[model samples]
Structures are given as C-alpha cells and as structure tokens.
Target: MMGHAELKALAAAALLSLGALAPAGAECSRDIAVPVALIGVSITNNNGTVGGIYPEALRAASAKAGCNLVFSVVPRARLEVLFEIGKADILVPASRTAARDQLGIFVPMIGHRATLISVQGNRAPITSAQELLDKHELRVAVVRGYDYGEQYQALIKELAKQGRLFQEVDTVAIARLMQSGAIDVTIMGPTTFSGAVMREPRVAGLMDKLRVEPIPELPWSYSGAYVSRRSLKPEDQAAVLEVIEKVAKSSVVMEGFQRYHRADILAESVRPR
Candidate 1:
C-alpha cells in the first residue's frame, strides 16, 4: 500500500503530464492554425460575424477537438486574394472544381448541393424554364467565376448559344440588385439568399413577389475543408479530412448550425429558390 504522501505525489505528477497530452478531443491528432478564413457568403457567421455555414460548424468542431481557432471573415472579392496570396489557412464550403484543385488541396466532399435559379416578383412571375431561356439576353447576376468546370462553361456556352447573358457580382450585390430592381435576377447559394433575407429588411416586400425557377443542375455548393499552400502537409491534410468525413456522417455539425441559426432560416439558407 502506498503512503498518503506517495499518493499525493503520484496525483501531482499525473496532472502535470496531462498538459503534454493531446487533451480530451474529437479530432485529437491535428493542431490547426487559427484565424482560418471562413471564406464564403456573408450569411456564414463566425462567432456572430458573417461567414459561411460550414465555417461556423468548423469553429465548434475545432473547439471540441481542443484546437484554438480564430476566424477571418472573407467576402467574395477578398476570397480570391486570400486563396492566391495564401494569407489564410482554411476555407470551407468551396466548390471543388478542377480549377480549385489546381489551387490547393481540399477535403473530400460534404456532399452538399446548391442550384442556380432566378428570383422575380409576383408581378413578373416566372413559371417555366422557358421564361429564363427567352430572357437570355437580359443581364443575370452571378458570382464571378462561379462556373465549376468546362462542363459548367459548356452550360454557359449552351445558354449563350441560345442568347442568354450574365453579369457578375458578389452575393451581397445580388441581394441588393434584386431588391432594388437593378437587375432582372441573381444567382447565389440558397442558404446565403435566405440568411440575406433574414438580415435585410428590404427583402420582405420582394419575398412576396419572389418566384424561383431552377435554371440548371449546378454542382456549386460542395462543402469541404481547404488548406492553403503553407498548411498543406500530408499528415495535416489527412487529419483534417478524416475529421471532416467523421463529422459529416453524424448530427454533430447540424446541431452546431441549429445552435446558431433558426431552423427555418437554415432550411432555406442553402436551398434553391
């Protein structure tokens, strides 16, 4: 039997050693860098500031994994700069295009989808795909460089072949454009559009007038983790991807989303018009 003094010494040593351990965690293997840019639409709030939904989800998971994280809120224009400059370590909810594949390593898909559609008021109601086809000459607002591939570019070619044209703008501009009638219609992520409506008072009147029609099957919103040039190591990337796959198979991330945004908001947040 150990003496009381010996037992106390043992307890102290164990406690001291625990600081060097991985600590209790969900993803115990990785030490992720902080201020990872939660680069997406403004609807995705990071600790209450606007970011993407996945980034918000990632923040919670990072904490549970005992990883310290800081969020860099990035909008569409800045996203390109951040990605190219390698200024940030993480970007979530980016579409995994071959073009992006050239830029950096991405975790495999979270298997999310978003559609491209046009929103119009009840007065100018759009009921069929033909309406968009007919109005192809009109200026349509889309995120700059949003088309995912040659196939997507081919879709654009087909639209152009039929006489449709588009104007590029950030998601915020799309919302404002739709509200003020600056443009006929705009394309954005469903989750982003819904959150924009919730946050902007101008959308209420327009919401009543809004009619949505899917234009094409766009594979634009696959959620994944991104590691910039500096952060891309085989082991680090593997660990992050492993955790993403694990969290995606369960309700852990959804619960985190529900904690931050209302259910109705989330339901429409990423859904097509």
Candidate 2:
C-alpha cells in the first residue's frame, strides 16, 4: 500500500502535469487567494486573534509558500459544509477518515491521544472502553464532528442510541457543560483541553474539579491540513502541500506547538513512506 508521503508525492506530480495546461502564471502565486477554515474554538489569544498551535503552524507554512491566506474560525459542522460546497480551500488540523478522504487530501501534521475527563469526586472508575460502556447512566459529552476512530465512533453511536451521549458545538461548550454538572464525563485531546483551559478563565477555574485520564486503548491519530480537492486547482493543492510539508518540520511551527504545550503531540513529519 502507498504511504501518506508517497501518495502526496504522486498526487503532486499528477496535479503539476494538469497545472501545465493552464494559462501562464496560473499556478499558485501571491495573487491567488486561499481561504482557510479552522474548525473548533480559539484556544489562545494572538494579537487579538485566535492563537492556536495548528493555526500558527499553518500561518508559517502559508508565509513560506508565499500564498495569500485568509483565515476563518467556524464550528466543525459548518466547516465541513463549507468544504463540501467548495467554499473553503483548507481545513487545518483535520483528522483523516474515509468520509473526509473523499472530499479532500489530508496531509498529516500532528498526533493526539484521546483522553477522558470526569468530575473529581466521582467514584466510578472508567479504565477502558468497555468500562465506560457498562455505565449506561453516565452521560458522555463529545464534539459534534470529531472523528474518534472507527471503534470509538461505533461506541459513541451505541451510546447515542442508549441516550447516554451529549454532542456539543465545541470543546468550550463541553467544558462548560461539564462544569455545570450537565454531563457526567467528556472526552477530548489533552492538548485541546489544556489549550481551552489556558484561554478561558472560566474553564481554567474548573480545573480542580475535573480529572483527566488517558484512554490507552484508543490509538493515536494524526491531525493535518485537509486541502479541498473540489475548491483548489491541482497546482494550488500541490503548492499548499509543499508548504505544509516544508514548514511542518520547521522551528517556527515547533515553537508554536511548544507554546501550547503540544510539542509532544506534533507529528515530526508526514508518516514515513
């Protein structure tokens, strides 16, 4: 099977060939506009703008590529809708899934471990997926559009069928719901949860009330920039991929992740091919 890097190279070459047929100066250039849609809420503040390791990494890559990039923060569902309609050019830090693969090209950027958080005083222990599933009374909260892998996704579906799931708009809302005791437990990436706690004072204040634990059975998944195949021309897709591959390993991007305490989670490179 072709690996991600190999697939990317193959796609780039094919795209470049098609790009040659376009009018002169039609390739990805400074004049070309790139619309980047970011899913999820802002975690940190950057010069009055949303500061996130993923966004910072993307900005670095965009600068390196000399592409004119515009950023918009939207809910995950809305972001998907925009991508499907060819209104968005890119989605930063998107997870790879069979459904998403049909819509765009995913270039791996980082890896994240899904974690479970619950009220500190809760005595019930949830050490594994089965344990959590056994507790039918526990209300588990999750972000609406998150892809938590096939197994977990299936488990979530089962939970939903049992009326034990709470799908919220974003991490902040999940955190807020947990704080208010509206939900029994919630699952999210530690880095994401930490970023939210750092950016929002209300969520930060509830830290002591929450307990975070890793779900070891759940495998780590890579999150990356998903370039819209429907919206961007082949040359544009290749250019964006080139930029992401280059800056994804650069110091600037690493520093951005470090600032958010996500250095360990950042993917060192596209999964080796």
RMSD of 2: 10.6
- Write down the TM-score of every candidate: 0.66, 0.77
lDDT of 2 by residue, 25-81 (tens): 323653333333333232344565754566666665566555656665567777778
lDDT of 1 by residue, 121-150 (tens): 344554434555566545566666454455
User: In candidate 1, which residue ranges exceed 4 Å CA deviation?
Assistant: 1-21, 24-52, 108-110, 120-134, 145-149, 154-169, 216-221, 252-273
By lDDT, the best candidate is 2
TM-score of 1: 0.66
